[model samples]
Target: MDVSRTRVLQLIARPDFPEPYERLAGGSVWLAEDVERWITEHQPWKADQEAEEEP
Candidate 1:
C-alpha cells in the first residue's frame, strides 16, 4: 500500500478492488478495515512495510 497516489488511482480503478463505500465531494471513501484486508490478502509486499516499521 506504500505506493504513489497515481498507483492508488490505478489500483482502485481495477475491477477486483473494492468499490468505494461512499463518494464525497472531496473523494471516494473506502472502509479502513476493507482496504487493510485487501492489502494483506493481495499485496503481500505490505508485510515488508510492516517489518520495517516495527521497533
Candidate 2:
C-alpha cells in the first residue's frame, strides 16, 4: 500500500475498511482482492498509480 506501518494500521482501523480474513498469532490477514477493491473504490488515484507501476 506504500504507506507507513502506522498509517496502514490507521487505515485498517477505519469502519469502512474490509473485515480481516483471519487473525493469526502474528497479526490479522486480509484478502488482497478485498483490499484492492476497497482501494479502487475509495482511493482511485492510488489504484491508478498502482496500475501504472505494474509491468
Return the lDDT, model 2, position 42: 95
Per-candidate TM-scores read: 0.75, 0.92
The true-versus-predicted C-alpha distance at residue 33 of model 1, in Å, is 0.5
Identify the leading candidate in terms of lDDT: 2
lDDT of 2 by residue, 1-55 (tens): 3689999899998999999999999999999999999999999999999999999
* lDDT of every model, 2 decimals: 0.84, 0.94
Instruction: Show how many residue pairs clash in every candidate, following the order shown.
Output: 0, 0
Among these predicted structures, which one has the highest TM-score?
Answer: 2
Q: Give the range of the ten consecutive residues with the poorest summed lDDT in model 2.
A: 1-10
What digit string (tens of lDDT, one per residue) describes model 1 on residues 1-55?
2689999889998887888999999999999888877877888698668758888
